[model samples]
Target: MGALGKENKDLTGVAIGISVLINVIGTFFFPRLLMVSGKEYGPAIIYGDYKNIWVYILSPILGAVSARILYKFLEVTKPAKPEPWHCNICNHNHLPFF
Candidate 1:
């Protein structure tokens, strides 16, 4: 739950794709163009200074949301297993028995 042990490649790709899609949509809708001084999109983003800073601020939020979705999906598909060491008395196993 803390660090997401391991995620499948497909799941990671999906998350990245979703993040890109969200950012692209935001670009079309948000006021990113207004901040464009000169050069391409990437340079313009770094160059301009906006009080709100929607794109720079919101991209991370989208990425985080995508990552969270991917994590939840992995959790749903992940296999459940018993702990390696079994208790002799009660026939129970500690979570980190291994």
Candidate 2:
């Protein structure tokens, strides 16, 4: 999107936030909705067990949000002039091959 001149940082952040929310909801809620009530299956099925369900639900969201925060911090801290060869004092003869 940035290469195509459609760079909207706010939109990107919103999309990431929404996707994380949907993933958490689906992970914790979808399986229970699929199970049939009062029917005998091969074994008992459990969904959203209290022991670790919150961890499963929140970890992805926290990780993604933290990553975005880190990215934003790095973006703001990044130097405006990225090329080292632009400085005349540097001894480098030519730009390093990317």
Q: RMSD for each model, in Å, please?
A: 7.7, 12.3
Tens digit of lDDT per residue, candidate 1, span 1-98? Answer: 46544545546677678756766776688645333323344554687745555555575678579767967765745667865677788898656635
lDDT of 1 at 86: 72
Report how far residue 49 has shifted in candidate 2, in Å.
3.2
Question: What C-alpha root-mean-square deviation, in Å, does candidate 2 show against the real structure?
Answer: 12.3
Best by lDDT: 1
Which residue pairs of candidate 1 clash? none
Give the Å shift of residue 98 in candidate 2: 24
Runs with alpha carbons beyond 4 Å of true place in candidate 2: 1-48, 76-98
| lDDT, residue 71, model 2 | 56
